[model samples]
Target chain A: MQDPFVRIEGVSKLFGAFQAVRDVNLTVGKGEIFALLGGSGCGKTTLLRMLAGFEEPSAGRIFLDGQDMTGVPPWERPVHMMFQSYALFPHMSVEKNVAYGLKHERMTKAEREERVRAMLDLVQLTQFAHRKPHQISGGQRQRVALARALARQPKLLLLDEPLAALDKKLREQTQFELMSIQERTGVTFIVVTHDQEEAMTLADRIAVMDKGQVRQSGTPTDIYEYPNSRFVAGFIGSITSFDGRVTAVEGEVSRVDVPGLGTEIVARSVAGAASGQAVTVALRPEKVTLTRDRLEGPNAIAGEIKDIAYFGKDSLYRVTLPSGQLIAVHGVNAKRAEAGRPDWHDKVWLSFDPAAAILLTE
Target chain B: MRRRPIFLISVLCFGFAFFYIPILSMIVYSFNGSRLATVWGGFSTKWYVSLFSNRQVGAALLLSLKIALISATMATILGTMAGIALARFRRFKGRLFFSGMVTAPLIMPDVITGISSLMLFILMAEWIGWPATRGFTTITLAHITFSMVYVTTIVQSRLISAERDIEEAAMDLGSKPWQVLWDITLPVIFPAILSGWLLAFTISLDEVVITSFTTGPGNTTLPLLIWSKVKLGVTPDINALATIIVLVVGIGVVIAGWLMNRAEKQRDRDARLAYRANE
Candidate 1:
């Protein structure tokens, strides 16, 4: 973040009476893969389009590498986009598509061909260079779109829902492939995606947008662990939150009286929360431990195991407290078959460390 | 195949007989050796030979072909520009009115279009003093004015189904608006434009009322000549000319159909390739 390569300054877009993006400001560093992650109709795509010069902000300004992008046409800007549909020209071959942007550059024919070959090789599509887009699979088409967008060597690249079309396996594989490509090319990428996991895996930093405003902007870990609002916490991952009031505040800890848990829980004290203030205590499933051993803490409670969703490497155990509220706890299935594992309807003790709970007062 | 109902079969036969009987009779009478009208004679190729060498037929045919070709090409260009403007430029002053005017000629009666264009040409001649003689140029202008409507409709409908992302992608890749149009938009809609040209060409070739209104002395198109000849009296040579016209047009249609089929086959192959790509 030393040098801000792409800076969006108080950008806002309005479609007649509807405001699509509202007072959004962000800065992306060079060679960093930044993500604008949000759900549908959240203005994530709108912000990305504004950066690519497709839609000029109705208010505010955008700067790319110290150059003002206002009033510049998409073709004149030093940024390219990979559309969600990939948008490969059906009439053109893969090589031709990758080489499309190069035709206007002041390069020799040989240089253009060499650059195209290098790009095709980078996307691992050299063998299908002569094939049309429909002649290739969807995964290959996605790579072709990537290769085409990167061929121009612009100051930045915009990718909108880059891997939404692929199956789960291909999406996961392409997520890493995209990161590797970004590393190799050193081109700043602004990826817009609805998939939170995609943003977490592919981006160095993410801006989570909702309802035309940015909720939080930070690294993946920072946003997941230290979400500023309940919306961000719920949107980013699965977590059980309790409506509570802070009963007491001690050094670095707060005792919250949660009616949902019907217990006083000790959690990490969040800034700006005082005694008698309303706060929401959020606990992630993986942070809570399901054990039979006696745990001595206000954060511990005895509950009956209601359900268990078993994965190969891990299992999610849902325990219902006497207050009739269920809390999810994840346990790693390390041993092949454990002897003393609690079954359905078995009483179990659920404990979470005071530091693991996220206290929000928004 | 299951046996079709007698009523359906009879209706189909009656419909086809109603259409093809005139053409069949015309073809059959073209080889008549007798000079008297409606008199049957021995088979002979004299009318066909004479029709080929007739100077008036040649002149009219050449003029019709020239006007049709020029008008079709002009209509395709102008109509495609209008179509792209309507499709790409979503909002502009008088866009609705402009689009309405562009498509109005499509449903306008041919007589109205002909008379209006004729009056407009007269006014232009008196005011601007250009096109002093209304012959090939006047006929061509009138044909283009009407045929461009069909072209615009075709191009616009094709573009409705076209993916906007391709053109946006081209522009994002540094292609200017005009360049994007030329490299991406036009190619994507080339088939539509081509079909439009063919439609315009065929329309112009056979348009009788419009041609009759706009044409000047000594500038007879084939349709006008045929109309005049049939008015005078049906001749074996006229029948021969009709047969030749049908043969040429039928061959062109067959070729077009074959080409479209081949394109469809290519798409089928692409589908097979897509299936294979899974493995």
Candidate 2:
């Protein structure tokens, strides 16, 4: 069997007394746009630096395309990094900046110029080729950085916070541009960003890291729907968690008595589930349905609408349960002009399916 | 309103007069037809013509210029390396001491620096018999020692403000460490180095105290010559030489300031442009 395009074998890094990255193992397929998502100082940037050969791992090894890249320097490695600051050569023109990496290659002057021209065209900055970095707009500079990093056609491209510098509207636009460019080039990309939405939109798979450890690695939907730990659940999306103990274990499901909602909840059984084990029942806000009448069958809780936050397309309702636990319920704003919507202090029923409750053991 | 306007104008005039009166008097007397420097005489170009004819002054001027040019260039090279070492290597064992020693010359008295450097050169000569005698070499060495501190300060500040990630990015894009330094680091800090060179040149050209201690019989720089001539009382020809020196140094300083200001303004304009682009 062919090995993965990039294989990180238990890589770890130590800076003086602080361990920045710890025992990280990952395999990325060819042409995959993988994202390392985390908050500040979670080892995402450290891992990206290691991949670019800027930092050497204290333990284990990294293999790229079946080659051991243990002692390779950054210049010799067939990897390029797009820095968060863009780091475009301020003294050089955009065309020159794009052509800089190509200088090391044994190409003729005409071939180098032709390659730069084609790269600028690819990033849609052909007109700004002669302009210096400071003369162009920020978005244009970002494109110049992208064009430069892509000019050499590296086997692996690392993007550090690729869209973090742009405004929201611009970020959204560039996210699509980045994905399309990656698709066209077929180069394996590993993006490191603290922005979860950016990672979800851009990456085919994401590794959520915290405290120098990978908490979870999966598709965006898999991470959101089936988080293995409480940290992953809270990091990926908005979740309301309740402390409970398993009261009964059935064939494929379990019943948990949650004192917070003063109800016995039925949820899909997690592995190693047994009677009288402490667990957490995490539910996404959008999974719950709110109605004025009491919900029939199981998994219904009696509560009152404590507060309401109205977004343009949706309203988030904070419901206070009988046991004083406030759980959030997100409902679509299907009705126009303040009709058939629960107001503050109105009694409501929050209901969800048994399968919607994620049973997290960790 | 009348009192405020009158007060502001008086203050402005006083500041200008206090700064320019001495230089103005010197310039005016440089064209005096009389031999006495302080007396008002008819304007003539005779002192200027005599200044060109004075071979001693010509020799001293050339010597000072050569020393300044050579020392400033050498100081720039050494100082930039020291600056990069201090700024980039954060946790080296003796970094604090190294930085302190580099900056010590900035605050040290010129008399002490001159005495210490002179003693060291004398001791080295006695021990190794290398320099043989104190002359242009000792004076140039002395100038380089003190002037390097200024260059180091300028280049160090520039290196501190410059993003090191730029160098890292260059390396990541298929350039070695040396290549990154040449292609990214040096070009970014070139402006500061240039201004530092000009400052060192001016300082070396006009230095009198340290040069006095380091020079031997034949190594009389322009400043040393001026000092000796002034001891015998100032002359109109001396005034002519001073005026010429002032013009040259002033032009050099103005060009340096203009270059620094232009670089600063260009940076500001680019920053403002980037900020507006975000909006």
Candidate 3:
């Protein structure tokens, strides 16, 4: 097997007495877009900074293409970083900004110009060569920053919240554009972002971080479908959780009896738990089906509709189970609904597939 | 609500006259034809010509210009470095002590600084057998000691407002630390350094107390010459010299203002270009 493009081996960073990153180990395949997704102060940005050589790890080592980069400075490393603020030199023209790193590469003037022109064209900023950074709009500045970082043809590109400064509509469009650019260039990209949707849309794999450690690392589908912990399930998306005890285990499925909902739910469990062990069952709102009549399924609970949030394409129903547990059911807002809609205060049955209910042990 | 127009105009006129009357009188007396310093005979440029022709005044003006230029240039360089270091680097063991030492000259009386520097130079001369006498070198050194305090203060404030992330980003893009300093840090602080030089120059040129104590017989500066002339009773030639000095200072002020305006416009243009590029 070929080695990963970049490998982080037990990397840790400490600021004086406080540990900012703790025993983080991960690997990035060549040409893959990996995301470090977390909230503020979760060490995602710190990890990105360490990869860019701005911060040295207090413990462990990092390797890029099988070469150790433990004590190398940022300027000596073959990695480039796009700062969150898009730190473009305000005094230089766009062409000068993009060609800044090439000046030190011992290339001829013509070669430098050709490379700079190619990068500008790549980022779609060729016409603004003579203009300074301030003459451009926010999105244009972001592109210029990206072009500047890529001009050196770095082995790895680090983006610190690349689309964070843009508005909602622009952020969505730019996220797709960034993904396409990464795909086209075949450069290994490590994007650090706090936006879950941004991570889901752009990253081939994500390392969801909390506090200073990776809570979970997997594909977006795996993270969404089978979160290893309650924090991951709650942080990734909205989830309905129930306190329960395991009653039986059979192959890939486990039966959990939840007292509040007054039902036995068969859920997929990766973590082995003996019978009578306390656990939590997580179900996504969109996975639950709501109907007026009682339904027979692996997981079914009778409840009364408490409230309805009418979205354009989907409506969310908040149901109060007979055991006084609140659960949410998302219903499609189409002409032909999947199941009959239950009005507010009406008694209903909520049912979910056994495979959809994930048993979380953490 | 608007007040009475005449009342506002009257107040403005009063304020203008209160400031300009003495300066206008100095200019008027510069052209007086009479030898009696206070009484004017008629308008003539004889005193202006004599002011230029006088050997003592000429030498003093030259000495003052040389000292001011040299001292101000040195002060600006040292102060700018101090400012950049203080603003950009994190605090260390003696950071507070160093910052306090840089600013101490600003509040210390000129007489005290002049006397102390003179005494120190004398002691050094006794110990090392150098600086044979108090002269232009000592005066220039004295001027820089005080003027650098002001320059460092101004430059430090300007550097504090500049973003350090710009320099870090330059380094992140594979530029060395020196390159980042030259390209990003220097350009951002250039305006502050220029203005600080101008301020130091003007202060050194107009200094009197320190110059008086540190200067020898042949090293009298313009202010020192003017002080001596005042003791012998001021003449129309002195008025002519004063007017010329004021005119030169006015031109300097205008030039400084123009340079500051140009720098601000360039900064704005750069910011606009960045904004457009981001779009």
Q: Evaluated with TM-score, which candidate comes out highest?
A: 1
TM-score ranking, high to low: 1, 2, 3
> How much is B245 displaced in model 1, in angstroms?
1.4
Clash pairs detected, candidate 2: none
Candidates' chain B TM-scores in the order shown: 0.95, 0.92, 0.91
Off by over 4 Å in 2: A335-339, B1-13, B124-128, B255-279
lDDT tens digits by residue: candidate 3, A1-362:
27999999999999999889999999999999999999999999999989988899999899999999999999999999999999999889899999988876878999999999999999888989987777778888899999999998999999999999999888888888898889888999999999999999999999999988999999999999989999999999899899889998887888899885677888876666667899999999999988888786677788899999988688999999888878888988776455455688998888888888988888
For candidate 2, lDDT tens digit of each residue in B1-279? 699999999999999999989998999999998887667779999999998998999999999999999999999999999988898885889889999999999999999999999999999999999678999999999999999999999999999999988899899899988898898899999989988998899899999999999999988999999999999999988888988878986997799689879988988897787667657
Per candidate, native contacts kept equal 0.85, 0.78, 0.73
DockQ of all models, two decimals each: 0.77, 0.65, 0.56
Q: Where is model 3 more than 4 Å wrong at Cα?
A: A336-340, B1-19, B31-44, B262-279
B24-116, model 1: which lDDT tens digit per residue?
A: 999999989887549988898899899888999999999999999999999999999989888889689999999999998888999999999
Candidate 1, number of clashes: 0
TM-score of 2: 0.94
- The TM-score obtained by model 3 is 0.93
TM-score of chain A of 2: 0.98
lDDT of each: 0.92, 0.91, 0.89
Residue A307 lDDT (model 3): 95
